[model samples]
Target chain A: MQGFALYPFDPPGDIAALRAELRAWLAVNQPQGDIVARANCWASFDADFSRALGAAGYVGMTLPTRYGGGDRHPLERYVVIEELLAAGAPVGAHWIADRQTGPLILRYGSEEQRQRYLPGIAKGELFACIGLSEPGAGSDLAAVRTTARETAEGWRINGQKIWTTGAHFSHIMLALVRTEDGSERNAGLSQLLIDLDTPGITIRPIIDMAGHHDFNEVFFDDVLVPHGALVGTRGQGWQQVTAELGLERSGPERYLSSHALLAALIDAAGADPDPAVAALIGELTAELWTLRQLSMSTAAKLAAGEDPMVEASVVKELGNAFEQDMPRRVQAIVTSGWDDADDLARLLRALLIASPSFSLRGGTREVIRGIIARGLGLR
Target chain B: MSAAREMLCDTARAVFAEAATVGMAPIDNAGFGLLLVPEEQGGFGGDWGDVNAVLQISGVLVPGLPVAALIANASLQPAAAVSLMAGAMGHSLALSIEHVNTRQQFGRPLGKFQAVQQSLAVMACEVRAVEAAAAVLAARLDAVGLDPLAADFEIAAAKLRANRAVGVVTSVAHQVHGAIGFTREYDLSRVTIPLMRWRGEHGNDAYWAQILGRQVAGFGGRGLWEALTAR
Candidate 1:
């Protein structure tokens, strides 16, 4: 809560060449599909694009080379991530795996777990989904009732997880389940990496307001997996999950999700835009630039082995507001019908529906603000 | 911050504390104007980073003084104003947090209330954003060898961002402080009023927005990313 001094984002090697190489590769490999898909492109799933990008050594850039990663710097990975998000790349497929799970596994997973997951994750062929939110746990994640009991055969799990993004398509789920019987809130929780195809497990699609099946309601009824499925130390799931959230909250994705809309608006406005459009563009650019600086500094702090929980929360809050407000502000200023099929119109319509979930996802607005308040030593 | 910059800030804080009551005489005598002067010129030979740090202290202690004007040129005034605004807004947030944690209502400290905590959180976010802008702008200015034209994009972005944040930062500070913050005798206005004035001083929202908008428009849509990353 002291002065928010920015940590310098000094990545190793030739960063300019890195960006250039990636841009060139993307120019050839990126799917030139509908422009609307590029708006919140990170959530736009394209397995092919992800695989190709991973083949180019972009995925899991921070992991060790032995794990099929490029062994690049975290800031280097950050640069690649920002470029991908800014370009509106369809990075949804491996987003979770590369972002948090891969690193988490590398950090907390046993050698066998890392050997099993990291290579596939680094290959971008294996997909992972978060299993934090349950029917009883949304904002109050500690209310997670999912239970995993150790048996003679294995660990048997029984519960339901709602709002599990990518679970329907994921190969595995790193879940927070109650492992210690009679355990209370957040006390007996442990993280278990469950293979989604385990017996008695089921995944049902939860179509969003936008009519997209990005999330699912996953049920685990007597689902049993090997004892090795446990990740990190038992009963440290709460700490591990909170650490993972620090990675999830503050990233280029928070702000750049709706970047395509801003780009579309600017492109549609032409070189000599009207004063109003110009003002709006200027305003958005200023906020975007500022958010980028904040996000990068947070990433730098994280890379420097410092816990920037407060700074990360600040980024998520501001970045979410900037992104959520972009569409509404554009809709108010621009004269575009909701049903219009043009790039700008369609993007506006899509994002207007998608914007509400910006603050809702990763962490809700209130929850994030509370974290900031606590960081201020208020609680 | 580097050791030199830390020492520089130490000097700034002490001098600015004295200059708080004596006006700019102490600042003038202390040679803050020579901060950006080259070492060969018999001055303190510092970068924009040093200026940013010193001006931030000036903002917190002597917001009414023309410390920014003395250190940097008119071209850099907008960037300097951002540092000042960042410093002032941070102080305002610190004041709000202090007020809420100390002031009591309904038999409890205001900070214990969720509503008050949420407001301060929002205020803290704005303050942090401005601080990041000021720091990045200083980095850009130093990277470009203090050339205003080379750092034009950062200058406009930082100033406009700071300008836009003034409303939230000032309002939240006052709201959380209740009536005590509004009094002239209170120290909140020392930073809040100066923040209100500095917002329109360098480049107001519309002014920087228009200039930045036109500049970005010229960069084109896809070109904007290229230009941003290139810098």
Candidate 2:
């Protein structure tokens, strides 16, 4: 309640029931279809799966039921998300909205905004994209130059957003725009939920190294929105976005991204893997558990409604490295699969192709390191 | 779990798990006390029993370093670590190094051989016995009044066990690595160097051994086994 603390990772009273229900649900509903997810990459979207999750009341789980949420704890939501992700459920479309935006609105949205947006978001009919990165402002959050000019109609937005994940498919862009053109740097920023179908907005796909159109570059051209769309006080964009990043950055997902592969690899290698493999796996497992505790602890702190920025940053920086390394080591071992009869070649091929983006996607390693240095008072 | 015991373990585990969440990673993963607060500042709250649980869990993770970190802490906590904290400015690490050098192997690091492992096994057994005795005494301390000096003695057993175990174990680990372990960033010494340094601090193996020897001398031959089973 005071300092940023964490929730307990131990199972709660209802956990056994929750686990059983969720386990059975997964068995029945493994996302397997022509358009369903293979690895549940948060950028990959499938409409039916999104709609089905909402129908099952699994969307916006931690928010209040009045807003169409299930009124669950964040940790409970974490368990659900963990299970869904591990099962490779087709949740890419709903992930951003459910994981970040719905909570953001609940925390800072006005009544009109909440009534208009949250229920649909919780129902998974509406999806959101964070429009923070730009051609010039990637990872330098404070450098956002997108201008939102005030007019009688509302705010006229004009800026270009880059690497907007799911932008091509999202219903709304929760864009951080520069308001007032104030010289306070971080002080002039504001978050605006601009409808993607707005007259002046344009979206174009950016194909990645993996040949996926999961990211995009979006342009805002005099896009008009009502004044009520501004989140919290207009001038506190920096503060609000900082809080948003904290939510995005930490938690179980940070380390669990490559866990499926880790589990598979460990099983293939068996216990007492070669000294090198065992050492690396052992190292990774220790860090994974440590990060799990740290993230869960931070979630507990946030559950008590406290800002655990430092602890969250510690988790993120460490998690970033751990996540990035898992795929690399997996690749190394899988590469050896060609020669070693004991190697699982098929699994190795999948890991070799997918693990490349491990460091770049979540948050860049460099960005996280900067946060860590600042967090440690080394800045 | 007793209410006091459960609360103590949970709170301490949560905080420690958090503090320990940070490190330089693989090289830094070999950490124990670095993450734990000092015992007197209401830190490392788990008693001898906690130490045993920690060791058991340690066996699961980095079987080698997990034990190494705990042993390192034990070495530091009692003989050298406590003394250093108490303002014992400078001291030599005899017991720590002697175990490393004198041990024999395949013309290698006794610090590097299987024979050292045998020695290390003996040391581990000693640490285990001392930890068991201390755990019982810790429960006794909880039930009775405070005896800071007796507590210090418990701390001593931990250190003696730690010093001997770390010295012997690390030497063999280093031996297995050969020359590569000598590199600065190799992660080999992530387990070895710290043990070496801490063992050298105030008292290494022999330093703590003398203390145990004196206690044994005080009770004639009965001191060794009696002090161990005193719980």
Largest TM-score belongs to which candidate?
1
lDDT tens per residue, model 1, A263-339 = 99999999999999999999999999999999999999999999999999999999999999999999999999989
TM-scores for all candidates: the values are: 0.99, 0.63
Give the fraction of native contacts in model 1.
0.81
Candidate 2 docks at the CAPRI level of incorrect
Tens-place lDDT per residue, model 1, B100-126, is 888889999999999999989998999
Q: Give DockQ: model 2.
A: 0.03
| Alpha carbon lDDT at B29, candidate 2 | 41
lDDT of 2 at A298: 70
Candidate 1 docking band:
high
Predicted complexes: DockQ each: 0.88, 0.03
